[model samples]
Target: MKLLKIAFKSAANRKTGLILASVSIALSIMLLLVVDTIRKQGKSSFVNTISQTDLVVGARSGPLNLLMYSVFRIGNATNNVSWKSYQEIAAFPETDWTVPLSLGDSHKGFRVLGTNQDYFKYYRFAGGKNLAFAKGKQFDDLYDAVLGSEVAKKLSYKLGDKITLAHGLTSTKFAEHGDKPFRVSGILERTGTPVDQTVHVSLQAIEAIHVDWLSGSPSPIKISAEKAREMKLNPKTITAFMLGLKNRTATFRMQRKINQYRAEPLLAILPGSTLAILWNTLGNFEKILVAIAFLVLLSGLLGMLTTLLSTLNERRREMAILRTVGAHAWHIIALFLLEAFMVVLGGCILGLIASYVVQLVAQPLLVQLYGIHIDIMFPDAEQWAIIGGALLLGLFFSLLPGLIAYRRSLQDGLVLKV
Candidate 1:
């Protein structure tokens, strides 16, 4: 306790340099925590975007491509699975539930999902959590729509408010279904996933609006919303579908069956496996981020070391004074070590505070702009391990200055000026 006090007092005498060193450490730690937390949570949230659904089935494509278009809504599907093929697979005795998805529409930049009541009933996310309504009920009419939490919040939509959807995934006024505007029937609760950015409408609405749209161009004849609802609106094909099987053991068998169906070429992928492929594909990027974080930390430690080494020359007299008071060389060493400990400990604490502050300040903006949800986290074992490692590194780096101070005898401190 005495040694720590002496060290702290010594640090106080050089408040500006020590404080600057600590701030560098703090910023480095903050950067590290920010990157690591985002990386871990981003991957976790990505992997768990939808859960309990055994397979994502789509037209034949690479697993990553299928996963991207089907789940993440990233790219256009290579081809769509015929609705007949979807029904055939959905009828499998091993199939527990299925939700067909028709993509390629958008409302104000958010993807439009053409699905049935099965989506609201059977779709799951974040480990089987059911999709719940935040404001209203599911789509009940051909022209009814359901907004994701983000869409409703961003667009300020309410139940019964009419909204129009565009033909393509990008927003352009020329391609909007102006004549077939749909009423907002419900708004879904946030899922912290891609679902939050989707606009939900009945599969028939997709067929109805596009009836006059041939090859992405509007036909000369215009069908009003009322007139279109009267026509048969069964979809000929869909972008993809998600499936849950009756038993986990049937997954591979059913996947193979889907892939080998005679009528059409298809692809079936385990959501978890495909997501793993996606994550692994970006493994190099992750490594680069981690390397950047450590390099920042190393530079901070180096800065602190530089400060301590510079101070040693001027503190020679102070070391001699301690020696005159009967303090041993080890005590002299312990003082600098304690200074390192205090600086690093303070920096880590401040860094954690800064991390939470960043999460609080930037989480909503990130979700809004990019659909990235960064969970605010309390330090777990991994974080504590990082803190411990930083402390060890700080102490180890401090040893050089400690040894330099130790080597200076009483004679050196009392030596006459040149």
Candidate 2:
């Protein structure tokens, strides 16, 4: 009990130094925890964005490019698959269902996807939940459009609102599809994927909108909207398609068939395999981020050590008095370790609180602007291990000053003075 009281008084006298040490440790914990969380959640978000789809078929190109255009809506497709190919693949015995995607043009910076209603039924995300309509139904007419949750909110659009497509994927007006405006018929629930950032319309509507355009430019011969309705507007090609397999075992067989199809040199890739490849190519960048975080942690620890070592001289008189009162060298060592342990524990708690606060403030912006989902919660198993390691490190470093005190006590005992 006397030893405990003495230790408490010692720490209280050095309250300012302790606070600085705690702050440094807290910052280190914050860097380590948040960096790990971002890495894990980023991978989770990427993997969970698409589910249950066996294959993504697109033109011959880099698998990452295909994924970017088909799944992420980030880039334009180099070439499209013919309608005949789509039909042929859909008719394969191993295939269960297929959703075709025709991408070109944008409405207010959101990519417009032209597909059938099976997209809502066949598509799954983050736990196999099918796409749900937040308001109204799917597109029922050629002029009706379905807005993504983000598109509707960002543009302040509601059912029956009219929006025109741009000639390109941007909102800039160098070339615009102003003549063909579509009415918003529905809004989709937030899925935290590219779906949340897209505008969906029927396949016929895509052809209808591009009828007067040739080679992505406005045609010299213009036709009225009423005349376009009378003309045939069926899409003959599409950017890509998502296939669901009837039997999971036949996935490889179907992929081989598609790749070797005589109609065209099509590429069929398993989403999981492509995703792994994508991560492997990009994994080094994540490692660099983690390394930088570790560097920051090391710097923080050095600061704590410097602060402690520098302040030890000023506390030498206090330590000598405690020794005079019969506190052993080992007791002094335990006191320093306890102080470091307390600071580290408190810093970890504060760091966790700060991480949650940051996530809360950044969640909506990340989803809205970048479509990244961050879950702010208790640390995972890996994070707990990191915290444990940090605590052990704190104790290890704390011993440096404790050892100095033990040596000083031994010398002072022989001289019987400070």
Error of 1 at 55 (Å): 2.1
Error of 1 at 362 (Å): 5.1
Indicate which candidate wins on lDDT. 1
lDDT of 1 by residue, 160-277 (tens): 9989999897678898998888999999998898888889998998999999988889999888878887899899999999999999999999999999999999999999988888
Q: Write the per-residue lDDT of candidate 2 for residues 123-164, one digit (tens) a residue.
A: 998858899999999998888899989899988999999988
C-alpha RMSD values across all candidates:
2.6, 3.0
Q: How far out, in Å, is residue 145 in model 1?
A: 1.1
Whole-model lDDT per candidate = 0.88, 0.82
Q: What is the TM-score of each predicted model, taking all chains together?
A: 0.90, 0.88
Local error of candidate 1 at residue 287 (angstroms): 3.8
